[model samples]
Target: MHKLLPALLLAAAAALPVHAALPVADSQGEPLPTLAPMLEQTVPAVVNIFTRTRVPVQQNPLLADPFFRRFFDAPQQPRERIAQSLGSGVVMDAAKGYVVTNHHVINGADEISVHLADGRTLQAELVGSDPETDVAVVKVAAEKLSALQLADSDQLRVGDFVVAIGNPFGLGQTVTSGIVSAVGRSGLGIEGYEDFIQTDASINPGNSGGALVNLRGELVGINTAILSQSGGNVGIGFAIPINMAKEIMAQLVEHGEVRRGVLGAQAQDLTPELAQAFDLNAQRGAVVTQVTAGSPADKAGLKSGDIITHLNGRPVRDATDVRNVIGLLRIGQNVEMQVMRNGKPRTLNAMVEQPRATTVNGDKLHPRFAGAIIGDIVEGMPFYGKIEGVVVLEAEPGSPAWRSGLRKGDVIVQANRQDVADLASLRKVVRPNSPLLLNVQRREGALFILLQ
Candidate 1:
């Protein structure tokens, strides 16, 4: 696409004004092809957003201890200050003044307001938001408003002409034009579920939650992030495809959160090295690294060493794609998957289920597991190779476990110098009135704690 795209873009740019009326002049008196007609329909739908948030400053952990805290006047709950941010939004429903933007734009906002193309500003009430997809919806009380048309993002193709409308660098409303550089771009670490529409459009810091539209003045994507080392646009920008945003918006609007199905499996990308080692013809697929026993995948006969090639007939590009497809599926829905086993493709069926929290009775493991649900890594709880230990599924705030310095994601590897490999062994070791010693490990690292 590298060489072919430039020629196509040049042809498209050359043909832009020949179909329409003659040239015109802008405020600077420079001869410019009239984009006013197109911008008129879309620019009004794009609104400026300002938000104010109050966040507490983090305090040192030592200051939280009773004895250490007594050394000083209990440090008043971390001081909070108002943080203000600005962005852009697209009005999707004119009658209701429903505006869609990135979740991060309105997250933790104490107050949100929308400034229209005219000299009017209205307070906006957050309707819903989904952090996983970084999409959000907010509504304003208004009667006569302009809304943009939403195009089927799935129909967008590479090199398609597109424009980004937003307040770049807080310079009011600005429009930049570029062609779609790529599609289905994933593994960018921008959001939990990423199926982005890549474009060369000039998106900047304040452009978050703005609109990315096509020639027909149809909303196709939401301007999100740009790949830049100097924090400036480098002709590489990303947008949340409107189709994915639409689906997430619907669930957020109705349920106030997104509910995704669990596959009970951990997978890795199908790299060229692994693909060759597995003797597969194509190098694009997700390889199962681990599958929990009796899980949805296991009940469907999936096992380690299976390469997932497709999900519900859609070709799986990598582990992220597999996750994207499954995470969007409704719970209890039957999922059809295609896998390559022994160099041959086979079909497997499974019912998408929500991962159940498996726990053991922690009454006896008081002060450590008391008021907490403890469990072994059995079904779909994230575990690395050869990691065997009891995990705390849930812990009450200020509970015995929390007081004893055990966190929710921490894995208890050793207790009282004894390796607590499983629940039975952990139960056998923890005793009452004994000085407790615990070795906990998280993604950050491991530490040893002594509890009296």
Candidate 2:
């Protein structure tokens, strides 16, 4: 791509039409191609965002200890200090004063201020934010704002010319130009939900939540992160597609949260060896590994070993694709899936369902479980739809459960040496005034948490 850029630039130059009115021109007295025309229409929509948050200050272990603090007459209240940061945002609705930005920019912010291109600064409030997708919406009560038109990011292709507008490193309103390097990029581990548009645009510090626009000055993506080891732009940057952000923004504006649904199926990437073992000719798909009983997948007659080729009209390239598509859908929405079963293609339909939240008070179960909140595994929880078990929703600090090594998000799969899949099974295994034995799964590994 590095070598190809010069040729692309030359091709672009040759394709441009000359005009005498523009300031930039060729040696022959004709105007040269320039982005000034598009940028003039879009730059006002991009904004500089400043935020302040109050966070607890880390102290020494002795200061944290109650006995040591009492001996020295230290302050009982934890010390808090204000943190400040800067980023960018795009004004999506001029009339309503709606601005969209990255979740990380305003997360935990105590005060938010939006600075417009015209030098007006207004106080802002967070509408909603989704950390998994790293998208957020803020609302400011202001008039005469400029909003950028949204483009269909799905139509974007590799080599498409793009412009990044943001406030980089507190330098007000910087613009960078580059080509779309790739699309539909995932598995980057940068965000929990990712379908990024990879570009060579020079996204840098304070560029988060900026606008990535096309030649027509239409918003195509939101600048989110850059891939660099030295914390500088190295011709590799990522942006969340506007389509996905639009969806999340709507949900955030309406419900103050994203109501994501589940398909109740676990799948793995369809590898060459696995395809050969299954006697299939497929080159790209996700092989179904498990389907929960009574789930939408099971009710729709989806079975294990089925290879998913497409979801709705989108192609499934791997297991990540399958997960990404389903995770963005709203509850109660109908889904159509194309799968290959036994070397033949088939179509199945299922309605997305909301995961149930069944929780139990820990103190009611046993003395050892006091001060903890246990619940059934649901969507957004670790290992949801992949494992059947109970998860610790909350474990109060300095409590019995916390002292006994129990914490939030710990999936308890076994209790008293018996398989405990849900709250009922756990209840049946628990005994009053007895030591509790729990086989727990925490993120990537499993361990035993004993509460005596």
Tell me the lDDT of model 2 at 325: 82
List lDDT for all candidates, in order: 0.85, 0.92
Candidate that scores best on TM-score: 2
What candidate 2 gets wrong by more than 4 Å, as runs, is: 1-23, 58-78, 365-372, 380-382, 385-390, 395-452
Per-residue accuracy of model 1 over 226-270 as CA lDDT, tens digit each: 999999999999999998888877777777777777878878899
**How much lDDT does candidate 2 score?**
0.92
| Model 1, position 254: C-alpha lDDT score | 74
lDDT by residue (tens digit), candidate 2, 277-370 = 9999988999999898999999999999999999998899998888888888899999999999999999999998997679998998988788
State, as a TM-score between 0 and 1, how close model 2 is to the true structure: 0.82
